[model samples]
Target: MERLLINIKISVNEKIYLKDPESSDLGKRILKHSIELIHSIGFECFNFKKLGKEIGSNESSIYRYFENKHKLLLYLTSWYWGWLEYKLVFSTNGISNPKNQLIKAIEIICDVIREDSRFSHINEVKLSKILIAEYSKSYLTKEVDDENKEGYFSIYKRLIIRIKEMIGQVNPKYQYPASLASSIVEGALHQHFLREHFPLITDCSDTKTTTSFYSDLVLKTIQK
Candidate 1:
């Protein structure tokens, strides 16, 4: 039965790490608690020293995995996109219709997130909240070009490319598949932020309604 079972792992790029956190127990603890700490306190106030204290380890020990808190943010955001791509693939697999696949993709991206035990160290639900509130900070920096060169945002770009390709299949004449795909993803993130902080700005009163609006938006835009 062990051989019949499968394990899912979200791989972050090697250049983002000094040491692979998934390779060791201490590393996993650092990652798990770092997510908790950052989500609880917000990234601007989060640091290795604080993370170390929460994980019952030294700041130097945490440094073994990530160079700085910003890199840690990159790793977290990278891991999220990687995992989301996996979900997109799994969720839409074997579907014959491009429109249906696109609808599934939109629902997957827009719906409220849930934690998966397959990644024991990561809480995807909390990570989704982080993505809505803090994902921009991952790349909005002076070193963005440098980090892009290292492929830090490659997973996110690939996710867009996948969705964009689906858009092309549904509407081969559409001139802005890339732009539309990115807008959908970013718009969903913004809506999530607004729903949480300023509910009046969004049409969604709940996740179900929120998901419906995105589903309708994708279908309407592409069919137009």
Candidate 2:
């Protein structure tokens, strides 16, 4: 899978960035350090100046690639989802059993993240941390409807659709496949957050527990 991913591009929507970070070294540095800086300082405190200082570039240079930090956050989150969608598709491609395929999808979505060597400039693990910590900020905005119309969230919505179809395959009569699928994806992130900060309130203490909880919930909910 890693070898297959080496050739993959994980494209984000063109409107999300002023420039493609993968096109040059400075652009890649912007993405690399931005992820590190955001992971280290949290997005509320993260800014282009801090990212530029970390990457040894002027703040203006960073702006040439991303108009502002909010757009940069969108680029990062969008890239992360696109990358995960690739993993989900590749991982579940040939599994013939609907139940087994859906199980694999859940596992991939809820599993603990590790650094993927295929994309060295960006850290998958830290990116996952950013997703868990700050993904909602990408779209929870006054302009979200406008951005949605522009297809800024298409990759994420497509992922939900894929899971929804798999759920239907598992149980043809299921009435709320889309809701259930979105819940699994969004709920997995919420569970991870709870496990880290509000452990007393969540049963998912780690990846295994989290994956198990969702797998059981989905199977039972859609059982014929």
Candidate 3:
């Protein structure tokens, strides 16, 4: 799987960046350090100037890649989704059982991220942390509708649809496949956040527990 992933390029929407960050060494540095900085300080306090200082690049150079921090967040989130989609597809590709496929998909999305050596510059672990804490800020804005129209959230929506189809295969007559699919995706993230910050309220203490919770919920909810 690492060999396959090393050859794959996680593509994000071209519209999200002024220049493709993956296209240059400096741009990749921007993405790498930005993830570290945001994970360390939180996105609310992150800025290009800070990122630039961390990467030892000029602020203007960072702007050459991303127009602003919000767009950078969008790019990061979109890239994460794209990378995850590949994992889901590859991991479940030959599984003929619908229920098994769905379980694997849930596990992939809900599992705690480990460092992927294929992409050395960008830390998948830190990026996952950012996604858990800062993903909503990427879309919950006044321009979200406009951004949606431009397909800013296409990869994420596509992932939900993939899960929705798996749900339908599991229970063809299920009335709320789409809702269940979306809930599983978003709910996993929320549950992870709760586990990390408010452990008393969430029973999920780790990745195994969280994956088990969502997999059980999904199977029960879609059972015929």
lDDT of each: 0.88, 0.91, 0.92
**Stretch of 10 with least lDDT, candidate 1:** 1-10
Work out candidate 3's RMSD over C-alphas: 1.2
Candidate 3 per-residue lDDT, tens place, 55-130, comes to 9888999999999999999999999999899999999998999999999999999998888778888899999999
Off by over 4 Å in 2: none
Candidate 2 residue pairs that clash: none
Off by over 4 Å in 3: none
Prediction-by-prediction clash tally: 0, 0, 0
TM-score of each: 0.96, 0.97, 0.97
Tens digits of lDDT, candidate 1, 155-192: 99999999999999999999899999998888889988
- Model 2 lDDT-worst window of ten: 202-211
In the range 95-179, model 2's lDDT, one tens digit per residue, is 9999999999999899889888888899999999999999999989999999999998999999999999999999989999999
Q: For residue 114, give model 2's deviation from the true position in Å.
A: 0.9
